[model samples]
Target: MADRVVAHQGAACWATLFTHAHYLPCLAVLLQSMRACQTRYPLVVMVTETVDARTRERLARMGCVLRDVDAWRVPHADGSLAFERFQNVWTKLRAFELYEYERVVMIDSDMLMCHNMDELFDLPLERGMIAAAFACTCNPKQIPTYPAEWTPRNCGYALRPHPPNDARQLTKPTYRLINSGVVVLEPSQEQQAEIHTFILRHTERVAQYRFPDQDLLADVYRDRIQMLPWYYNALKTLRQCHPDLWNDGEARIIHYILDKPWLLGPSPCGEHTHLHSLWWDAYASLAAHPATLSMTRDEWANEIALHVRGI
Candidate 1:
């Protein structure tokens, strides 16, 4: 793994977004997990201007290369008040604007890395093509808010690899939907502009983007994507909703799809109890680090009790 990572040295990096102050705690635990994995690649934390100077300083102290970016949200394009809440998520596409890094593995701040995933950097990522896991369109919540197409049968994972070989990488699925939770991106200014125009110009089309970045990205790059195995972006919901395709032991990273573990704390949890504890363990490890400067012990306890746990 170390030798493979060296091949992409100075050309690849890990990137994640932090929109505001509230998401800082989530980013802290994620960074802690990276430290545990001994990730050799630099992590570029893209932060919006909404984050204050204090939060920026804390991120710097955590050994992040901070890239200040403007907030990207176009609610008028969606034209629905109900979908307005997800408009902020469009900001995540800013990772594409980072043309400096040849290959950028962008992930959400809410996720936790279970082990060393530096191997993803070594994977082939051609121009105009991305590598990402297929979305488990199980529609577990059965919510009307989701698109009508989101069903188990329509999910990309439903397509079988004969003999159940998880090593097989499927590129073309009828659904062609890629989960943007964890994506291997080839940064390009031209690609960025094209996606931006596609979303803004196609107003009626963007209306169907119920999942914001996920919908828009999958649509724009559907034909030009390489679908990875489910383990890379293992959604927490799959444990029960799509258990046939899930194996927590094989999952390289856990995507906290519905509920974040940090917010759940040590309550009488049912759904993702062990997974929540996994995230808490990373937080605890971060708390004890000698170089830890972002959140003090008292501050962490207060945040969890008041803001997160709501005691």
Candidate 2:
């Protein structure tokens, strides 16, 4: 028989961040989710601002390749919570360029996975981008939707000292809001240039504005992206969209959007105790697992104790 042609299995990378001290457990949740995916991708790369000694040790024990960002080098845009989150993504985008990888998946700490995401890399992200949601606001749909000022400062909305209350609350979803948590980024030289230009121009907008990061991206990549299944980012919205699928034990990922398991624990979705319990059990089990964090019961208790007192 003729020799079979083996497909080229290019390398893929995963990225995430953990700066807020209390979010380490959530980061653990993310790690657990990643571990569940039975892919042979090289080490998962994580970026952090300020991780404590014990937490750092715990992560090291879990076989993660950790990288720390120079806080001084990272510009401090005084206002906006969204900007702080996107900044991590920006850092990952920059770092991914230096690393020689065929593709990279950038996920947020607030997500939980139930299956392998290697399929994301199989898609042609080089042609465009892959996001969970589309555009999710009207501003981006209006005339001249995408403002020229894409960098943090140049964005239409000027930086505000106080967080807008509206921004904090999860208002009604207008357009398809691309879930920044899970995305497939194919890093080519041209793509890197686009990412840099987009961030430099739109970052200020994200910094100064409230909830427009996804909107800005929608505008920028309006014609150059593909939308994956909602379950991929599976949050509260998915529950409403596919009550049966979300509850039918078919979801590949259980994204706890508003009721993040790491912070508040499981949810009470519409009195659906079963669904809520499933989420809780999945999270608790992941938290208790050794692969995620090697913290003992006592150490875990102490960590939460400090959290309760806000120390």
Candidate 3:
């Protein structure tokens, strides 16, 4: 058994998130990571969009609190992708200011903690937001890779242009482009009201946009949010950024969101088309974890297969 030490002593709490059944692997990896860290935070809450009977039983056995919400219930006008399903969950999380904890770190279910993050809460959100990385192209050469819709002006990347001569630009981007994977939020009625208005306005326009939630989050909060250290939502995107990440260092979370762990370990990019094994490894790990409740490999295969069929 791993040593169990509460990183926050007695006054800290954090949340690991998921939606529908796609969260199984993320939940398993998250719990195992927390266990490895020996974090003794009072509660480990799993936010989901209705868990199946099997998952509910499994989470209960692990002694994790499960909050089931209706994804469909989230206010949506057109329901493009309903990505804001998460924002609705955040509404529930933000309500916890009434709780005794001083900070709440919300993590996406598609991420894993590679190291202990006991010190993250210590960094106050006094006048800023906390996040892992920025969205879209960072390097000059990588600019063409993203579609125009994902560029700075289009509600995908930061709302500002990249600086030409600034070498530190990637390290400290000028605009607010928070990857929703890992965020450390301090509860404030002011912040929550802003967030609520942002969500409400986007909810009304989902019928017109393709990527409504991602669009709103990037566009609305572009100037207001703050960028945290990169390692927080360390994306497994490409090689250029990988070498800097130290397994024993400050990086707290690994967000394998796009090239999701369900399909691949790290996203296969460029000439790596032959590396389907990366995807296989991710699927295998999820299948092998003993703590995983419900939704077996066959079921996941079928689920993804359905996605491919439509594609």
Candidate 4:
């Protein structure tokens, strides 16, 4: 994103991205969650050029390390984005360019934290290894817009029990599908350049990827990828669709992959009222913070509640 990401090479940290001001609330809640958990790692918030000054100032005041990003200039054709909502996500590739940190965990902004996950920084990541959880392509809500291949059985984590630790994962690999939502990577200028070259040469193929940057990352790092316990990137739908694999108490982060609770769109995997409450509670804490939500809390809550539907 910046002309160059010159972070010190020995530090490890947490990071996230936001392309626009609308996602400010989600990013705020995530930052608050990190502080709540008392993590030692600093959060480097990557911002696209379009982000407003006020929002930028707010984030700075909250103690986030702001990095300006320039979108990768993907030659996106009509309907090329994996989802209509994923505008400018290609800028996420900028995370890999942060060649300063010894290792960086790029957590997607649209997720909720359950507890501190600082131990992730201490995990074994060899020079070329990129660690992440397998994506649950199980389109549980049966959203017709999603491809038919997104089935429960096709999901890499469907029947596998919760991994005790990284040994079952980092040592011997099982599945190939990797979710880009959460990534623990050792950033390097070489890999960043290689990824840029991959995107440039494979534009047509990369544009058709189901999850844009996600598929591209998988294709590039297939053999070098490692898995964390699913709880690290726990998809919300797992509770309803992959019940056998869902355990709330064990969760480290809850990736709201399908739809964000803040959007109050049709609830993903039916109504997980408790999950919604957790999101709201985090959001509510930021009521006193500057320039967040627009409406009175009661008014917005009532409006959002009406739109949230059960399957």
Candidate 5:
């Protein structure tokens, strides 16, 4: 409930990524929700050259500081050093390079803020601390090895099988993976250098991970991470797969996972309809005049192709 401007007093700010023009609507809604909730810190967005000038102007008009960064990539899994399409997810790691900010809480553009989460800035974060909520294990039935007694405290590692004759398996430590959607990071020159070094040292392993940023970060900071309460990042999957854990009143930020309400119409049944309605309501209020920047049919096809390639 505290609305203190702690981040501004220090060097921190709220940051997110704007990689593609198609994401403009989501970013607009996210910014609108942040303003509606009266967030205390300035909102900064990291963008690549691919983002159009008009979108950049719109973001600036919305009072967001725009930062231009080069797109980054990791090697392909097959030990092939071929460069994949630019992945915005990899760009999330650049948050650590904003040395001007002592700390930053990176929120995905797909998220909607229901309350002023300034309290996140007050949470104790050590030099290497990465704070985030545990990704909802809503479909436990699908995970064959999921323990019936699973709780955040006892769920230390989730095993990943290695190929036969892979001696590298002995060096890897399995750790619980945290969702990268909402993360509290303390950015420093040293931390940035460390991440860069890590990427260079384990480029092959990073490329093979299903979720690059999420997996690599969890691997590096697994021991230093502090798990936040689920209310901080209530995943929509919980509402769809595990209704028992869904409570709108307790949720401060609703993250639309696999399915986004903006792109898809509301479902006909269940409480998830209400959650989707919330997203539409925010979108309708903020995206009255959506950005003109849009992908062409061929560009859209290319984007789909790139996604299929998992880059």
Candidate 6:
């Protein structure tokens, strides 16, 4: 057994990645939430060259440690680049490269932390036990393939044949698919190298998955992952699908899945609408700060109008 002392010795940090300028407001809101909750760990943001100097400056002003990383390009079966499918998500893989920290909790900029979830860092980290919450199951009505009958208990794992040839069969049932919006991982140079190699080795196969990073990470960690309670990644969809578990006061995190609150018009009634109001409250808190007052009124108005007018 690896010595617990050595395995858990280094500092833990909070990290997030965004490749575009449009996400800056959301990132600011997320960072504000972290500060509001008084997170104990350092915060880091990974950006590609696409993020402009102004945005970088703002992020720096927010006390975020900014790191530049390259976006990953998808490759063809013949070892050539596939331009159409080029993804910025590959930047998230760099979380494993954060060797300075023993463990990194990667949160997506689209999420809001309702409470201080520093307790997640205390969970066991042996054998790369990535801690994450199950992604909210899709509405079968919206997605025909995913049956409405499917519940968390029955839908955690499905037996799908391995790609490139369905000859070998593997039957290991693990927790349902995890949402990559928030992830807890212990950085390891060896694991980082292994993940890189795995991506390169299965480049063609990777193209087939809906979400490359989430699918790849889930496939790699499967049974090894530690399942956090649903409150950790309480998706907006849960309010409609599983109201029994959707308690705003108790949820540690609220993930703005599919339709982001910042991009939606006000609805007459719905749980998601309530959550959207909360998101605006968080945004307001950040925008009202004297340091962040320079954030243009036009930017805020435009965001609201775009959503209100259904643009």
TM-score of each: 0.87, 0.67, 0.62, 0.83, 0.76, 0.80
lDDT of 2 by residue, 193-255 (tens): 775576577656545443343444555665554566555666544454434444545456655
After superposition on all C-alphas, the RMSD of every candidate to the true structure, in Å, is 4.3, 10.0, 8.1, 6.0, 9.2, 6.4
After TM-score superposition, the amount by which residue 185's alpha carbon in candidate 4 deviates from its true location, in angstroms, is: 0.6
lDDT of 1 by residue, 7-35 (tens): 26558889988877778667777777777
Indicate the residue-level lDDT of 58 in model 6.
Answer: 63
Per-residue accuracy of model 4 over 30-115 as CA lDDT, tens digit each:
87788778888999998888888966876777688998877766666577565776656778879988867878999998888878
**lDDT per model, in order?**
0.74, 0.52, 0.49, 0.73, 0.67, 0.68
Summarize candidate 3's per-residue lDDT along 20-119 as a digit string, tens digits: 4555545655666666667655335544545577656656666576555434334444434424444444334443342445566666666666667766
Candidate 5 lDDT over residue span 1-311, tens digit each:
32323343577788887787677656766887887789888888999888889767767766789988877766646422212332447888888877788779988888899988988987866656788866543343344333333443332222123111232332323335577889998777877787788888987677666556777788787666676766688777666554555577988998977556656653324546887778877765543433322334454334322332121
Ranking by lDDT: 1, 4, 6, 5, 2, 3
Compared with the true structure, what per-residue lDDT tens digits does model 6 show for residues 77-179? Answer: 3322222233566678789888888888888888898999987777676665687776555453364434344454443322221110221232223234677
Q: CA lDDT of 209 in candidate 6?
A: 50
Q: Give the runs in model 3 whose Cα sits over 4 Å from its true position.
A: 1-10, 46-49, 68-100, 127-132, 138-174, 188-190, 200-224, 238-251, 264-311
TM-score of 2: 0.67
Q: What is the number of residue pairs that collide in model 6? A: 1
Q: Which stretches of candidate 5 lie over 4 Å from their true place?
A: 1-9, 78-86, 137-175, 266-271, 287-311
Give the least accurate 10-residue stretch of model 5, judged by summed lDDT.
156-165
Compute the lDDT for candidate 3: 0.49
Sorting all predicted structures by TM-score, with the top scorer first, yields 1, 4, 6, 5, 2, 3
- Candidate with better TM-score, 2 vs 5: 5
